[model samples]
Target: MVNFLQRFLVFLNIYSIFADGYSFNNDEHTENIHPFIKIGSKYYFINELLKMNWFESYNYCRSYGGELASVESHEELLALQNYILARKIESRFWFDGNDLAEEGKFVSHTTGRPLIFNKWSQNNPNNVNNEDCLEVNLYNKELLMNDINCNVENIAICKYREPNTHCSGKNSLMNQNEVCILRNLVESFAQVGHRCKSCSQAFMFPTS
Candidate 1:
């Protein structure tokens, strides 16, 4: 009976969250939930500790409601590069660019489109030893892109996709608070066979 009640509460909590027409598709909803830093119009989460291969990095970002960072313009690229330099981080980080579909034709894994902007280092994309993954190197005050082997581990940088603006208007705070309460309720029942892992991940609720 206790288990059934917990499951029912979880369902009700999830239902309440959606009943108001709000969903996790909104990046604003996660602003206070995750450790994303806002830069320009997008939010980014840079993992300086955990290193993963290109494919692993791609999925890691998606698991956090984002995708591997993609450079769509020179200004955006400069902003990101500047951020790295400002932080004095010296690690190569993975981006969404790759030439897996076609050699010498780098495209964004996020959008499946040709990279709109690239600041390649001297003679980059050389495909040296089957290099197909893209990474940004910050060395000697220079930020440049390079293609490397997909299996090479690198820091994962993720950019949150543009969010739905439905919750940007009046009463936004009230709505957000309600969603938070619902998410908490669902998480509270998670250990009771409620299985709110998907919902918790969507909202980035702390697992502990």
Candidate 2:
């Protein structure tokens, strides 16, 4: 596992350099460095302080081989919030948490997992004005989550497998957690598709 993590770190750094280059970020402030950051096992892609509607943000993340950022837990939420605040960004931003999948049920579009943790402010998520999207209220000291119109433009925060990463998105029945972890690990491999078959097997049945 240590060996694998070390390899993953190296690959992530190289990928970061590639993404920071002009050809890759032609329109989104090509000069800005640190396009993304890896925290724990997830890779987060932050825009050049640009604001876009939730739908646009989601699609943009997908185009780059990822999905909208998922603040699955309070710790994760606070960590990201601090990271943004540290940059002196006072703007509230978008993260994956919406009831679009099912009315009154907010789940991550990327993983289809129910929202388990939240920091919603008072009277937030009131679904006012037919709002169905989620955003982090940066100005709120408590880091409240709020429901807003999907079309409302806001800073886009995305996370998932990095761009240029390849995968089959296929895996046998196995530990869901491991699958998620491995999915991100092999994301950068062009041959990860067919390779996942064997790779998944190896994890299920280890050698030695």
Maximum-TM-score candidate: 1
TM-scores for the candidates: 0.63, 0.59
CA lDDT scores, all candidates in order: 0.78, 0.69
Number of the predicted model whose lDDT against the real structure is largest: 1
Residue-level lDDT of model 1, residues 1-208, one tens digit each, is: 3445655677896677675655444434666647678775567999888999999999999998889998777778778888898898888999989898889999988778898889999898799999999999975777789999999999999998654434333444445544554555556555643454334442434335
Error of 2 at 195 (Å): 26
Model 1, stretches more than 4 Å misplaced? 1-33, 164-208
Clashing pairs in 1: none
Q: On residues 76-147, what C-alpha lDDT tens digit does candidate 2 reach at each position?
A: 877786777777777778878899867778887766788778777787778889889989876555567888
- Cα RMSD (angstroms) for every candidate in the order listed: 14.4, 12.1
How many clashing residue pairs, candidate 2? 0
